[model samples]
Target: MVTSLLTFLSLTAFPPAGDHYSSTDSGRVRLASELAWESGRLSGNQYALLTNSSSQRLFNLADSLIKTERAAVFFSPEHGFGTNLPDGVHSTDEQYKGRPVVSLYGNKKKPLTSDFGVADTLLIDIQEVGLRWYTYLSTIRYCLESAAMAGIPVIILDRPNPLGGLISEGPIPDSTLMSFVGALPVPVRYGLTVGELFTMAQHQNWFPLMKDLKLTVIRMDGWKRSMLWPSTGLDWIPPSPNLPTFQSLYWYSGTCLFEGTNLSEGRGTDLPFRWTGAPWLNPADSILFNQSGIRVQYDEKTPVSIPGRAHKPKYENERLPGFTMKSITGDRSVLQSIRQVILSLQSAGRPLTIKPYLFQLLGSRSVEETEEEMKALNDFRIESRLYHFYP
Candidate 1:
């Protein structure tokens, strides 16, 4: 059995220095769900799980809860219960393992009071990719709101931010620009784990109504701020269909910007988010990266219909010239890379038509404006540190 939170807290009060850590150390990290299960924290309560296939792959929390008769109902985020629905598609209510599964991404983005049924507690265990546009963060926020209004305690099983917690990039979203995609005021690449983000949310009054909500974060064991997904020794499961690999996720923070343009962000292709282009672009024109250990090479790709993943994706069935990016070392600055791509496309006489949706994605009017605002992140960085569970 795993140690109690009290014992774990005292042991991890002072994290080890970053230089002494090994990236290849398997089994060094223990998930909060695993610890919670071993310690029997989930035995007595009927839990309404806000989770997806990624969490199922990681620990099978739902199956365990059902096996022990502690599952009340299951909740799914943007993609659906099994994550088999395409982007922007609404998932209808379904049955999973003889229990009702409600879709939070359907007609209603938040759970109704009646949806709770017999559940006394709300448990969130979905994996997040550490980007503002990832809808899982918004789903969690909505669930928190529902839990607060319903007068129930919430348990969050903390997971590592695939991009790591060492760096944050881009600018905070304007209050007027807040939507399901840009729910929080944090930067595009906010460096906090899901647990830390919600903790900071309650403390900082991001959602003033949730201030009194009973929230408990079952913290991960041996996870450090410097450790990325690979460093944590956790298997990589695609949180969403598009982000299939770490390389795809690494480039997503920057390349996702293409979604607002006429260019294809590699959707319907095997390399979604890793490859970006349009038929109008010239392959001979090179895109440069200022960050070290980064390489961008010219290539050609064709997007096609992939039922559950992407259907009728942008410029589907057309071959287009694009560039693929790969990182040889650690995480590189994604904002800088975005700027570089913008300049390169402009220089190639293919000036991008700025879509209104781009502002929502960047959380700013333009890349240049966002870059200017990024100069003032020192305060946010410091303020965020107060809620850090790991060093």
Candidate 2:
């Protein structure tokens, strides 16, 4: 394939990948001279793979490529072509700038390359929200698998995980609960950049063809371990519909648990996932609620101990008051503390009954069982620290 393309076109067009180039402190560089070699010799149909978060890199890379190569096919995820699709809006494929825009989301997720009829190289540049529950990761996994099967090389433009790269939380998904959402067994906060995550996935031999595929990761230049999302010096565009800010990212890893329950995950309000409520909660019940949303309930299954007081087992109503939304942070300390609050609510007799599909988000039943497993999580964290990608 490589030789045929070169034969069809002049051999001087494409530049070798090994040429080293450096960027300034901002990681921006002037276009290389070789890019001008093949200004306009071929038909325009090759594709650049990008999701909402990594879409910015598209223009940067395209500026250099269009100087020589033809225009590219663009692939998008759940938020649709331009990422303007609202929370649950149904999206359709369309054309932009004479190039076809393909939707990798909606009912069918696999790359419809056959449908497109002629896109060879698929460049992927999606932003991951750094949570297991987020759908973008699954979209990438599917794209990778399909691209490998079709013998397409994937170039991944890397970006930072907003929750930092040091911590891993939540439980690994069990085989039984696996879905598009939980494509692999990484923790809810598996702290690797999308490029590195693909590296780990390929190394583990998960996708057979993907293992041998030609994957090039354009890693972020100055990204460090402690630099949170705001520190990146880039604009913060929400990668998905509900995840608007870092606060939403923080509450999402835990509060996403609400998807399995009867209460609203705050979808209708300005703050989804971060502020949860039901019409059942009123000012009359506010006094019993805790700062972290846990309120005591009297049920019969589990009992509690106190000073001359054996409190009856109960369902604790977790009231997520407003402005606590502002307090959201996806830090390990914050996650662990939130985990304690959720498990405590579970131990208090409200054993969370998850939806069949949502079990993938929480990882597994082993992750859901309240009292014993939570303690095990602490132990797991210590052991998992060895796999830590960042400090």
Top candidate, metric TM-score: 1
Candidate 1: which stretches are off by over 4 Å? Answer: 1-26, 288-294, 328-332, 370-372
State each candidate's clash count: 0, 5
lDDT string, candidate 2, 1-391, tens digits? 5456345323322223442233454643222221222232122546654554335443354444444354466667776866666544546777755666677776677775474346666666666788766777888888888877787877666667777776766776656767867877677777777766776666546667687777665555556667677776766676765666776776777777666664455554556556655434444432323544433232112112221111221222333332223452233354444555555545555434546545556766643446554555565455443322334
For residue 363, model 1's alpha carbon misses the true position, in angstroms, by: 0.4
RMSD of each: 5.8, 11.3
Best by lDDT: 1
**Model 2: residue 223 alpha-carbon error in angstroms:** 0.2
Could you tell me which residue pairs clash in candidate 2?
49-123, 293-318, 297-314, 299-313, 299-314
Taken over the whole model, the C-alpha lDDT of each candidate is 0.80, 0.57
Candidate 2, which segments miss by more than 4 Å at Cα?
Answer: 1-21, 26-45, 57-69, 115-117, 282-323, 326-339, 346-354, 366-391
Candidate 1 lDDT score relative to the true structure: 0.80
Please write out the lDDT profile of model 1 over residues 1-391, one tens digit for every residue: 1245335434442222321222232466777787778766677889999998777897888899999999999999988998887788898788988999999998989998789999999999999899988898999999999999999889888888889898988878879989888999898889998988887787667897797898888877788899878888888998888888887888888888888788788999989988877877775554333233347678899999898899799988998888777653455486556755676666557756767887788888766754457565766787777668877
